[model samples]
Target: MPFQAGLGTGKLAVSKVSASEWRARSHAAEQAGDLNGALEILEEGVAAWPDDAALANSAGNAAMRSRNFDSAIQFFGTAAKLQPRLLEFSLNLAISLSRIARYRDALAVLAPFTKEGFSVARYCSVRALAERGAGNLAEAGAWFEQCLTLDPKHARALHGRARLAMQRGERDAVSRYQQALQVTAGDAELWLGQAQAMAIAGDTAEARKIAELLMQQAPQWLDGLQFLAQLRLAAGEADFTSHYTIAMQRRPQDHNIPAAQCAVLAGLDFNREAAEFARSAREKFPHLERFALLEAVYASAAGENERAQSVWNTISLKNNDERIHLARHQLRRGETDKAAILLDLVLQEDPTSISAWALISVVWRLAGDPREKWLHEQQGLVAFLPLQDAENVLPPAIAQLHRLHDTSAQPLGQSLRGGTQTAALLFDRTEPEFAALRDAIGATIQDYQKALPQSDATNPRICHPVLRYRDVPWHMAGSWSVRLSGGAGDRHASHIHPLGIVSSALYCESPPDAAADLNGDPQAGWLELGRPPPDLGIDLQPITAFPPRPGHLALFPSTLYHGTRPFTQGRRLTVAFDVRPEKEPS
Candidate 1:
């Protein structure tokens, strides 16, 4: 209680007075709703008193509210720099950068946040979006998954993933959208996203129901109206065409609904409307092969198979891009061998033609020759990817390659109650036999690398998946196992592996979500690995088709033909994969 006028106490008294004045001005400005004015006052106060982290942060808040993102960044940076221990400013900087589309920068900013990792759902959600827009899709996907793992109910992440899934044709996206609704039942945007996903999945019925709910919940949502129109047109509802035509009345650039409408009416004996819609779409974006494909479908349904085929032929020669679509139509029209020849020709010209490989995959699946196992792998590996995704769909043949020895059960490989099936298998998981496999092949690969000692990226064969086999390139990425499955009665297609690759399948546990489960869920479908057609001079005949057994394993060249039959019942199970020697470095 000594009235000793201490220097420190006097300095504190003066500091308090200045702080009180700043707070008063800020509080008044905030109460009056002049967030900008409050922010200006805080900036001045913090500038005068550089150690005042609170004042600096207050300015940042006001800057953020005013959408002055750059200023917010400056204020947050100053605060963070002045008080190096403060977590708030750094995190806020990451948030603001994310908002302004500096996602990669934001990610870099957030490296510090991973220290003891804060579970910021919105932070991860925004970061994932930024990464996606930045074209780092793989990283974005992993981030989106991380966001969901932290907060399964993270609405934005769920919505983004749903959109991604739809784009990748992962029919399960519709279910993810529904699950997102559980977390945000009141969120109209999530509802709208679900509607969009359903429509994309070709389910117009449920989309309409959700659209109706969205209209009720979010009357002003433009996406809801768009989805409603798409659903209506797809369902072939009365005057749906008129509805789309009229919607074009208010907002004519609605490519989404009209494109969908064109798709719906294309094949069901309705060419006139399909033509009209496709014409409008073509006017908007001329190079849509899907529309051309629709036009061909319309012509074919109208008993103009020649006209339809001509349309495909005309478009096919327009550019290399459309050839695959043309080939797809050829197969749909029962010209399977012709489609195969087209793809084969393309592959012969360019061994790594993505479109040719993709078409080859499609043909192999339909061909049902176990020899085509290599085709499926190539489809997965070499397709012209708008994005690498789940649709590198494993053909059923990749799992069980039945060389046309017999349409009967033959134990694959040596345990083969004879070589009645020379079929090779492919898988994704490891097995005990794979242990000797992992040891023997693993050692061989290492020794091979040691002898060669790769010095260049031109090594065609590189190990891709496993941790131990780190140096293998794409062509040489065999030697690993994968889990594959088929039901009681499934056969592979015909195909060949690439020049130096050896493919194999080792039976593992059956797909847990097999045929029985297929009927149990709307999203669940039977898992059958079918083969694609071969492109790269791979006239590899059909591999042996053996009925699936849990322990069965087969090893053979990439040139074998393979595919799977649609499962009627029981779960066909196995591990299926490929192995190839390292390409001699060129």
Candidate 2:
């Protein structure tokens, strides 16, 4: 086609000829993983019709598919500027901006469409989404409401509003979500919202059930994959990854999906792929702090200390929590001091920090009194606990994910008000336990559970043990037999159990070369357990501070916080678990 005057025609020519031709070429190139061919053709299209919105849009899509986010943004911006009247162009621009996390720019692009004349439901939906991306919760909510009134069955608005409600801890949102589902039952986003609400309400089993349903239905939803990973971890079922692996089948290159994959992967074959995938994710979504976290963990796991540290250094301020989260993971690799430094830094900014303080106290449980840390942790907990509105629990529920050895709470997050929880004590009475220490932890758990009632878990009174290993009783389905090879250092921050009606640490083997005590005694590290906030000493008399011995079990309720000291010796091997009872009939 000859060049035309109208901007749209120019676009049609470039996209219909040069751009479309390049796309076909790019597809074959990408299918063979030929980056150069794809980049050349895509870049050529960019140069051919820089002002043709469709051509630019096509170019951007090709770039983004190849993980060239900067190129994508550049091309998308050109398209958006050239054709500001087209909603698709603007939406594409917005999505591209979000990928680069230029959220302000994304919002600015959508801002013009939210004016008085922009009464279209789709326009309102676009603005609502942009506001949400900008973290303006209240403004986003209002826009979503406006969109809803215009189109009662508006899918995007319903989905976005339900997510906002979940984030803000809005109880009324449950009804809103149900209505949204009624409108769009097949929507993965709506399903995710429903699952999140159920998770926050401490109906994790229900959440898991919904998640399984989603997995069964879509099998490829990102949120569904993440939820299943967390749910498995929470249930002490670490390798429960069938659904997530299936998700990877659909989105093989998604960095977050692989991050979820690595979380549950074990064995030699998976270890290599998981570590590499984590690295690839870091390279792909360089701005997403969460990617850095996965990179750090995998690097540390692979004994690439410098890369892990380098990854940590690159994280921006917006990702402070992610760094802290990784630092805690280092504790698992035997990097106590490093983990401590991270905790201190986080506490410096948030002295009333729930996660840092809780894990800090838990890590130090073996040194002396755990009460002070416990007390300090309580302060953080109490600060947000008045939000008895059950809908607000998803973030906290996310925070409740207690990974083995890695105690960092930021891996999960506690960024919202916790509605009043009945705080019941759970102890899997049926599981095996050390006769000497069982009663002590059980009583302490009961006392604390009574004093601080949280209504998040089943059997809010006492949790009976359901799963145990050959020797490790406190461990839930998620416990593992892990050994760090070669030169390795680790960090495990503080955290509570997910399905931890009761939680425990068991040392199956100890490195003969690890550090001992303040006296430089050559011995294994201690498993610390305690409360948080005012950072009180666990006043359980002599019984509270138990020095770990091989074959000696340390069992405590899941609600009680805990962390492990970095075992400085050779090949520190341990197993841990969360203990909860078989579900009572509904």
Candidate 3:
């Protein structure tokens, strides 16, 4: 049972008995939740039997469990090469790649399986996930369906279908969830998806039931606890504090948990508790700037401007994130000059920083340099297009958007402000309806590019290091449809599209009175621009507003904060997207 030296080789070799003993001990350690111990044993076994795929795979699995994706990928790649017949090794490799957002690498690993016509359900499901991660939703959906058709009861395939269905809308999502549950009744992820869908569909009672069941059945699953807390916050339930407490207790070591809790509390106007949580998080995770940033943000939100400024000053501006937060704080305090300096420094360090560019535009606007100067500086500000048909009415595609919002798959994300939005990457889908919308948007973007003012060094959009666009070709960053329901029909909150060069809203349906409210503020149920988020303690009013109309497409700078006014009755459906101005090839 001892490791032996290989003949004429410098490597140590292990007898089958020794390898087996190592695996047994590793398995026991893993079962006892000592993943590090398990990995240590596996690594030792791998070193002894350098050519052994099984030992490498064991190490890979342990690393994956520990969320050490880089180590997992290394081990999995070695295992896959050592044992080409073991498709599971390749699958694990692909999954590890995907975990790090190396979607193209994941697809490359899956290529052999598909090229050789390995029609395994697991392979198809994994390939689908890779495609989805690469922003190829149509391909992902097809692969999921292909997997399901190969094996009707494949749990992973069912889960994929359910997830894609959620992007469509509530009814489709419910059907997929029901089908998935029928096959895999105990699947925690499916149950979580169903709960989220229920919440988005305004069936909070059913959502709560499902969430509670998840908590009972899988108490360790953080998604369940987080979902419950989110639902409570969304519904304005009094139990949000309790739910937040439970979530924090469940994952106290996770810095994101506390940071999210603090943001939510501050957003909900629980300033005192949020301030305490931020302070605790900052003290607990001194290395993490996010907690410190949260402390400053909470202080500002609480109208403690002096404290906010003081706390923010203590944060080292080593990264663009810290600089951006400080810049925002300065902007909130009406210190435009200071904010501009910080923002410019951020852009100087990372020229492609979309958020920095967005902020710079805001600073110019607030400085009141001249409407035209700032307007020109903020490239791709606002453009409107009409989706006219043969009869000059809205096209059928625009009309179909409303029905799609009602009947298609529901997205997983629910707006904090009170609306249901589709998946962020929906524009990549090649469905006829989606394709039409994409084409229309693309054509509009071309027009927008042609109409932009000449580039100047002072303009944020023109000053990007990686981009110098003569013809403003653009790439979609994200696209989603939102459906806001009646009774104070949820208005989108004032926020900037931090990641995009341009942002847009194409109205599919407007509440009836939005068009008819001519006597009063006329712009009721309209899109308002320039106001900062309410929680920022910024009192700036909207610079302008655009009334909602069917088939009207409104495009603006992603950095300019924009939102909608509430409508008392009827649903307002719109598609929103973000885009990056692509530099044309030389």
Candidate 4:
């Protein structure tokens, strides 16, 4: 065969080749920076040597590198099946399964190896991930601990345990990440984890220091830059994008820096600044479409709709995310029909998209589509229940929440405006008030579930089989407390919980004005359900409004848009949580 210019060596002749020769050829292609070519060679080799476990494993590796987890799963499954005794092949198969969120399948693949007493850290680590993804956090923790016991310096196990600890609001998370960094000092993720732990613990200064150090170490690292920006924004700093600017200066050719800067600005709700920065970025990187998209989205958010529409017209929509953003732009422009069409297309592609469901619900309501009620206003979909021991729970919970709201400003990407939300998960805290409140909230959730309408197969909310499960129907996915100082313009933005089955707000304390009549003066501080965000230009009124009462809980479908009206004075404190269906064991 003729020699190839890019290939390190001449092409192989069209004849029978050994598995080792095929692997070498694939390695040469990989070394030439042609990952697709390497993957093609490995797939051909797997076909030629179908029973060769090593060839199949090599093909799996190539597919995994290309981010084709589905193909990797098939290849790795074949390898594992061909060589059942080889732990490496089984572990690789488990990894691919985990990548695609087939956690139970991954667990099944690794279960036999555990009985074989392999005692390998990598095996334990992979098992830990599968268990975590399967929603068996305790078992995941045990596996991570076992991995660390076998190899004290195992970075993945250490990182995983630290993350689990953080989720549970344990202070040990900071130390666990620090311990991992002791041996793996150059690990960026460990540093980021440690910084996040510190920030959650109300040590923003220390978190900022770690993030700044990360920026210095890896200038083009977007996560590090975003964390730094978040820390600054939370500190109420006007120059939140300072470090991002420095990062761009440090890495001149890195186009991602400016794009990240725009994202950071927008994510923190600095809409006008995001639009301006994205506009400048678009000019600087004309070939990059992301900047143009950012400019359009943020411009719309900032009420510069004409500029947003102009930018929207220039760019080509690439994916569901872009299509959703364009739909939002259309909604803002009062082109409700166009917006509905786009949202319908998105829903057609991804029926499980919470954002698409939420947006389309708004569109349907505006257009008086009967399907809107079928989707969202189903009987008992929204419930308000009063807590049993309101008097005893309110005071201490309010005080504890006040202490947790130490930051001057709101956290990044949250809907809270003119308020501070607790960084740590509220229910995970050890405070007696929070503990009691959690128990009460759990009881209230049961009551709310009991009041729900009979399960309907076609109903989006009721269609999930997990909701009807016997042993464990639901679990609190996340919980937090938000304390809004009832100053002017202090209110939550209309938003939906994307990853939740049900969402709630349990008031601990509320301003005197909270109970004011909607007809009197601006629905002051009341929970308003089914209102689209004002920026979306949807003039439709809220379907319902619930006045804030201490110990009262409002539970609604997470797909429904909900927020609050601004109050004149005093404080409004509440604990909010998202509920998700418990994963059934395989």
lDDT of 2 by residue, 1-586 (tens): 1112223533354445565666666666667777656766667667765756887887777777777888888887888889887777777777777776677788887766656426778777777777776656678888898988889888888888887776665566567788888988877777777876776656677778888888777665666776776667556564656666677666666555666666656221244455676776667777776766667656655656667678767765454466466655566555666777777677666543445644555455545554443433332222111112223322322223222213211122221011111111112111222222234333433333345433233323222122111122222333322333213333343446644455565444444544533336443354455523111222322213334444334555454555444444444443344444433322
Candidate 2 off by > 4 Å: 1-39, 64-67, 83-88, 202-205, 212-586
Give the TM-score of each candidate.
0.39, 0.42, 0.74, 0.86
* C-alpha local distance difference test of each model: 0.53, 0.54, 0.72, 0.82
The worst-scoring run of ten residues by lDDT in candidate 4 lies at 461-470
> For residues 219-326, could you state the per-residue lDDT of candidate 3 as single tens digits?
556677677776665566665746546655666677766766676566546766787789898898888877777888778767777888888878777788878878
Clashes of 3: 10
Cα deviation in Å at residue 294, candidate 4?
1.9
lDDT at position 579, candidate 1: 58
Best-matching candidate per lDDT? 4
Candidate 4 ranges beyond 4 A from true positions: 1-16, 387-403, 406-409, 424-443, 454-474, 513-523, 568-570, 581-586
- For residue 497, give model 1's deviation from the true position in Å: 36
RMSD of each: 16.1, 18.0, 6.0, 4.3
How would you encode candidate 4's per-residue C-alpha lDDT over 1-586 as one tens digit per residue? 1113344466655346789977888888888888888888888888888999988999999999999899999999999999999999999999999998999999999988896534888998999999988867678888999999999988888889988888666768799888888988888998899999888887888998999899999999998988887788777688988888888888977888887787767765788998988888888888888888999999998889999989988988889999999898888888889988898788777766778878888888888888777776777788888986777777777787787787434777788876888775677665678888778788778887777766556655333322343235777867898888665567899888888878889988888864453335656888999998877877888888898888799988887889998887788888899988766433
Higher-scoring candidate on lDDT, 1 or 2? 2
What order do candidates take by lDDT, descending?
4, 3, 2, 1
Model 4, residue 563: displacement in angstroms? 0.8
